[model samples]
Target: MTYSRSQDSPDRRAEFPQTDLRGSIDGLLNAFYQGTSKEAARYDLTTHEFNLLSACLKRKEECTATELARVLPVDASRISRIVTILVDRGLLKRRRLPSDRRVVMLSLSEEGVELTTRILRRINRNSARLMEGIDEDEIHIFTSVVSRIVTNHDAIQNSE
Candidate 1:
């Protein structure tokens, strides 16, 4: 079930037969997310919850649920639910904009900030370990290919 580029033939078409390429990418993402889920659980957070927290940490600005939905893959309703859970857990602060009471802005609480920082350090260390053997050129090429794949996927989705 594992994939290796060494298994590919000289023909570029054979470099990634459709099903094999899809399977390889799926397998890689599933494995990566499994690890992430385990790590997030250690902090009493689901992968999605951790992602929301990380997004808040990165933005460092109070953002609306709609803004989060735009940046994240999750829909607005899901973001709202997660935000509610986070707010209840005291990991997030929710406030209405004075100018617009209808707009609820979200930011991390102090405790949330501390926990997120620790988790980020661990994630950064893990990522560094994951990239240990890979050179910068290989990383660049991989990133480029992934970007193209994502673009192609978006095009396909839009066509549908």
Candidate 2:
């Protein structure tokens, strides 16, 4: 659905109009990402780097650059560059797989773990502060809606 406002007071108030799902969802998604990126900026982590670290932490096992490329939406070349940089900076380890000498695995270093944990904690605190006044029921509804959208998107991508 679309939310529109008249020329008179478009800045302050908007009229809710019947619109397609695509635009509404796109707008909301963009806004949410912008907000997240802003929050992540405080910890001095580029969005992509934070994402890579977060993915590694979630895996809890040796993850390959290829796997990270598959899990993350970025291009393989970008992942390759990021992985190389992380390895060079001692934030991630690179090793050959015992099963297949041709393959390489990656895991977070101790320093990487510490930094990622600190950044996550900071972000979580910021989110909690931001949500302090919101109603619990509304938060639940919002979460349910976002989760359904993510699930549907994942299913479609997996099928492809």
Q: Which candidate wins on TM-score?
A: 1
lDDT value for candidate 1? 0.86
Residue pairs that clash (backbone atoms under 3 angstroms), model 1: none
Tens digits of per-residue lDDT, candidate 1, 1-160, equal 5665666665854654685677677876776777677778998899999989999999999998898898888998999899999999999999998998998889999999988888888777777776789999999998999999999989998999
Which residue pairs show backbone clashes in model 2? none
Q: Model 2, range 39-158, lDDT digits (tens) per residue? A: 557766677877898899889998888899988989999999988878777888988978899999899999888877877776677677757889999999989988997999889989
- Tell me the whole-model lDDT of each prediction, alpha carbons only: 0.86, 0.78
- Lowest lDDT sum, 10 consecutive residues, model 2, at 11-20
After superposing candidate 2 on the true structure, give the runs of residues whose Cα lies further than 4 Å from its correct spot: 1-44, 158-160
Clashes of each: 0, 0
TM-scores for all predictions: 0.82, 0.75
